[model samples]
Target: MYELHTDRLTLRGWRDSDLEPWAAMNADPEVRKHLGDLLTREQTDASVARFQAEFEQRGYGWWAVEVRATGEFIGFAGLDRVDDGMPFSGVEIGWRLARTAWGKGYATEAALAVLAYGFDTLELSEILAVTTSTNMRSQAVMRRIGMTRDPADDFEDPEAPEGPLRPNVLFRRACGARV
Candidate 1:
């Protein structure tokens, strides 16, 4: 299984038991604000299945993030192929956690490790992260992880079926480079 360790987090592949908490996170309105409408439990399960399949086939995907000290499933953070009609296409680093997990620096910590894994283990040339224009928290995390914002590269998300949330900010980091 793919696993990444940081001072307070463990990033690994998904588990069946993670479904409930993960779903709850996805279902939280506040957490889903920038992400648009909250996802149903069924939608969350499908997403988990897709992540697992991607990990198996591509050898990389969003890893299940856990609080190492408490053994709690915080959420997921790692590398994934954007695979959509966005400006950044080849690969990206992304994350999502429960509402209670916010403002804890967990996203930044886990993201750094995952970005390292992407450039080191996966030998990626670069990784990008995209978030809605209003999601300053995630934008800050992207900057904290050494990614630079590229307004010229911004594009609408083709995957988001829900309308206006499509316009997003694009952040990119080159391999072996740190901000």
Candidate 2:
């Protein structure tokens, strides 16, 4: 298993045991607020399978995030190719955590590690992060990890429902740039 570690967390591959809590995290309304609809167990399990396949095919994908001390599966954080049909295309960094994992600096820590791996290990020229205009939490994480945004880069997400989540913003951090 490929694993990336931080002082307090571990980013690694999926496991059969992750299904239950992963499903519960996706089912949380607050967690789904910026993410859209709650995902069914089947939907989440399929996502896990898809994520695993991404690792097999691409050597990198969303890694299952967990606490180092307690071995708690809190969420996921990793680098991924931009989804097809987006306004721009490049590798992107993302993180999602259970409610219990919120407000603890875990997202920031995991994201910093992801950015380092994307830029240093993978040698990507730049990394981006996209989120709904309303997702201040994720946006804040982007800023904390030294990604920058130009309001001019904001765009409408054609794939999002015709609502709040439809409007998206793009944040970028180029190689050799400092915050």
Candidate 3:
């Protein structure tokens, strides 16, 4: 039942209705361009399951974002524990919206809200965001939300293959930092 609302969106728990669109978004080449290879339906289902479990166990995770006025599920934006073995270990804020939702400022809007939740409600000291070096779109969203990139924090993502997808950049904003 955890929910965070902004002027036009709601970030909340996943629902059975989200599965179809979630799978479609995962299967989209354009949307998956920075995220890696397109995922099979089964793979997408497994990811949704993991997201749901994280929320149940930790009270916060990647939330299913919807257009508040229409109740249309657009994507997800929220916090996640950075897996161990990454150069930087901490909570990271991330988003993946359907291509239709792109260019609408929804990512920045939801991210600002999630950042507030992390710093104010969760009292996290910092939040990080990572994307492949070439993903200018996501990097723009990171900057729009007041995160700064330090070149020294960039690294080869351990989980990605040794190529275009591996060279990743990290952006961060400390709690209470200007936004």
Candidate 4:
């Protein structure tokens, strides 16, 4: 039920209308490039179900992002618990947008809002972000939100198939650190 608002975007709960566009976004090879294989519609729907459940249980999770003016479902952005087998444990920040939404600063705006909520509302001491080494776009957003990376923190992602996505980078932003 948690939601966020920005000048041009709304970070809100998932809706029935979001499924189609969400599936399409997941199917985008460019969007899923750093991420592994493209997701099928069933996989996409299952993921959304999980996201919704997580939000209900924790009061925060991947938010369905929409353009406030046009009401277009662009993608999702929010906080989630780091998966169990990752080298590190803590909340992680992430976002995924349709190609149409790229280069428009939506990720940065939504991410900044997520960080503020994590620090001010949830009172967390830190937040983390992980991405493939080649995911410069996400890395830029991480840096813009004041997350700092230590090369020592990088790891091989167990989830990624043996490929470019395996060598992952970890970035951290302590509470109160802001860009």
Candidate 5:
């Protein structure tokens, strides 16, 4: 099993036990604010299945993040393939946590570890991050992790509906860059 350890968290592969909390986090409006809408349990399960498949096939994907000290399943943080049609196609780093896990710097901490894994371990030359223009919270996390925004890279998310979510901002960080 691929696992990554940070100062306060562990990023590991998905488990059957993570389904309940994962569903609840997906259902939380606050948590879904930037992710479009709340996902049904079925949708959440399908997503978990997909994440597992990606891990099995590619050896890495969105990892199920947990607090090291408490073993609490806080949420997920890792890398995913940017869909084929996206403007800036490449691997993207992302995270999603329960509302309780917010504001504690867990996202930044876990993201730093994931970034290191992607660059240092996986040897990826670059990683990107995307969020809706209004998602200042995630943008803050992106900035905290040393990702920089390139205005020309920003594009409307084709997958998002014709609304606030469509206008997404892009952030990028190259391997070996200071963070």
Candidate 6:
């Protein structure tokens, strides 16, 4: 298991024990608000199964974020490629945490670590983070990690309907930045 330990969080792959909590978080309205759609239990199972498969195939994927001290799963943060047609490709950092897990710096903290892994371990030249324009909270985190916007690189996300969230912001940060 490739597990990353931060001061307050643990980034790791999924486990059988994580199913129930993962389902609850996916079903949480607040957590799914910005995620485009809320996943039903069956969908959540399929999602987790896909995540597991991706990890086995690619050696990495979205990692489950847990508070090491309390052993509580907050959400997930890691690198994923946009499956929808887009202009660029490679690892892109992302996060989805329960509402209760927000307001803390966990997203920023975990993302920075993933950025480091992308540039160092994965040897990626650049990593992108995309979020709907209206998702100011996520945009702030992208900026917090020192990623700059590339307007010319913006592309329509096939998964997103036309709206504020549809106008995706592409934040790019190269290697050499602090993780």
Residue 20 in candidate 3, Cα distance off native in Å = 0.4
**Model 1 per-residue lDDT tens digits across residues 121-146:** 98999898989888899999999989
Tens-place lDDT digits, model 6, residues 140-164: 9999998989788776676777765
What number of backbone clashes does candidate 1 have, counting pairs of residues 3 or more apart or in separate chains? 0
Each prediction's whole-model lDDT (CA): 0.88, 0.94, 0.94, 0.94, 0.93, 0.83
Ranking by lDDT: 4, 3, 2, 5, 1, 6
Question: TM-scores for all candidates?
Answer: 0.94, 0.98, 0.98, 0.98, 0.97, 0.93
Clashing pairs in 6: none
Model 3 residue 156 distance off true place after TM-score fit, in angstroms: 0.8
Write out the backbone clash pairs for model 3.
Answer: none
lDDT of 5: 0.93
Please give the clash total of every predicted structure, in order. 0, 0, 0, 0, 0, 0
Tens digits of per-residue lDDT, candidate 5, 19-67, equal 9999999999989988888999999999999998898899779999999
Candidate 3, residue 21: the lDDT equals 99
Q: What is the C-alpha RMSD of each candidate to the true structure, in Å?
A: 1.5, 0.8, 0.8, 0.7, 0.8, 1.5
What is candidate 1's CA lDDT for residue 41? 96
Global local distance difference test of model 6: 0.83
Please give, for residues 61-169, the per-residue lDDT of candidate 3 as tens digits: 9999999999999999999999999987999999999999999999999999999999998999999999999999999999999999999989999999878999999
lDDT of 2 by residue, 1-179 (tens): 57899999999999999999999999999999998999999999999999999989987899999999999999999989998999999999999999999999999999988888888888999999999999999999999999999999999998898989999999999987775
What does the lDDT read for residue 29 in candidate 3?
93
TM-score for candidate 6, residues paired by index: 0.93
